[model samples]
Target: MHMKAIQFDSPFNIKIKEYKTPTIGKYSLLVKVAYCGICGTDIHIYEGKVPFVTYPIIPGHEFSGTIKAVGSKVTRFSIGEKVAINPNFSCKDYGYDHHEYCYYCKKNRPHFCINWEAIGVTMNGGFSEFIVCPNTSAFKVPKEVSLKEAALMEPIACCLHGLQQIRIRPENTVLVIGAGPIGLMMVSLIEAFYKSKIIVSEPHPSRRNLAIQFGADIAIDPNNEVLKDVIKKETNNYGVDVSIEAVGGTTTAIEAIDCLNRGGKALLFGVSMPEDTINLNLFELYSKELSLFGSFTNPHENDQALEILKNKLINVSELVSHIFPIWKLEEGLKLMKNKAKDVKKILIQIEDNPKEYSEV
Candidate 1:
């Protein structure tokens, strides 16, 4: 059997090609992909900006699908079950290719494993008709969650991990820098779980309004209004208790640190370039006793992400502004690259006739 897939032959070169369908190992599952989200990492790989990515790779980590076949040893999941995949893989989990566990993996931090590999980033991903992944990497979707929404589980998990890093309090005042899809997801999660007084900084007018709609108490246009000034005014000069930087820029990262109160915590959830650097004031750090955190991939938060989606705690549907077929993925990527105000989360529909699943 053959399956169609989109492959990135090299930087700035992508094509749709047919290849023999992949089979599963004893601990694997063959999944018929439903929807795959195009993420920032995908863009980096496409432009040859990600140093770890190799050529001729299929790029898509945020996806959900139905299982068509399960390996004999995969008793946890059955055929026809809907599942979302966690792309991060430890050396051992990648087919046990390496017996020696990395330090981070042994410490229960596979996201930081020295030999870490991801399904889409370091291997073939879901920009195809079908995928074969370890059963351990797949999580079953709840009855209340649609495959479309389930496709967003990966990002949701990432956002959840970011929030966990900050340890947000319900009464804390929080500022989210950027109103991109990831930023908005942070906003929604903070509102739903922490009930924090949420403030958003976004230059785009539409996204600013969207932030407000997503429970932001104040949405400031960073291009016009000063973020620190606005934050000062909002918090009566105390600054926010927590600040999340989701824009993946040095300016926004500095803003996240600068707009914090004494003993404030900041989570740098953005994916910056390898060469990006920031200038920090050591005096401010010493005086305020501030804490800064860098969040990587989702380690073990996929189940919580699924629960959040199943309960409709976060509005994933509103975040999805456009859906493109697999063949039109490049067009979607171009739109995202142009920073279209109307484009939020873009999903690549893999199945020609996707089943009409009920939404939560």
Candidate 2:
């Protein structure tokens, strides 16, 4: 089988290549990809911000697919069922491969592997028709969620991990900075998990507007409206109890911290570039007792993401704004470059099935 893949050689240099089908190995299954979501990290890799990408590595982790061939020992999924894959790859046995005794993975937190080989970064991913991943990485999709929409599961799991980091009490006021895909996902997850007064800050007109549709109680553009004033007024002069910074920029990180009330928590969910440094008011930190930290990726949150979809707590379909074929990966990336106008989830169409099964 010939499959399409977007190969990145240098910064902003991605060209599609047709590759032959990979031979399946023991304990590895080949899946015909159905959809792969272009995440912010994908764009970062395209811009050469992410490290450890060998030349011509395919960049796509948020994906769903149907099982094509299962390895001899695999008994998990069948050929005809739809599935979502959590592309975080780790080698638990290899001492150098992964720091198994690390703070997170010591207690079986495999998602937070110290030496993680992220599917898209270290290995080829779902930018093609077929993907060969471990059987345990695949999650069965619900009958109601489309395969395209199921691609959002990876990001959803990530957002769920971010949420799990901080305690979202129902009494607290939460502010989500930057209403991009992750910010909007924060809005969606918070809606399902917490009933706090949720607000979103985004300068983009279209995304700020879509924030409301994604369960943001209020959407405030920092350019036009004062975020501090909005939060103060909404929370009766007290700032938000918790603030989530989803945009990997110094400015947005500062905004999230500034909006946080005394003793409030600021969760940095976005992975800023290594060179980027965020400024903090030490006085605010000392006097206000502000809590600031970063949430890297999912930690056993994939199961929660799958369960949420199965339960219909969050409607992933509403967020899927555009769809394109795998051959149009460049076009999709271009659309992502202008993502503010084309806001929300964009999925790559691979194989649409008539009936979604357990092992698709």
Top candidate, metric lDDT:
1
What is the per-residue lDDT of model 2 for residues 1-360, given as tens digits with 9 covering 90 to 100?
687677777778888788888887667788889888888888878888787777678888999988889888778777778888888865542322343356656667766666577788778887777888887777888887767667888899888877877889988889998877788888988988887789888889899888888788888889998878888899888788899998888888888899888899999887788888967789989999999877767757777787888788987777777677665666667777676484577676766522321111
Off by over 4 Å in 1: 95-100, 353-360
CA lDDT, every model vs. true structure: 0.90, 0.79
Clashes of each: 0, 4
Candidate 1 lDDT trough over 10 residues, lowest sum? 351-360
Query: lDDT by residue for model 1 over 125-145, one digit each (tens)?
Result: 999999999887899999999
Alpha-carbon shift of residue 86 in model 2 (angstroms):
1.0
Instruction: Give Cα distance to truth, residue 101, candidate 1, Å.
Output: 3.6
Q: What is the RMSD of candidate 2?
A: 4.1
Q: Estimated TM-score per prediction?
A: 0.95, 0.91
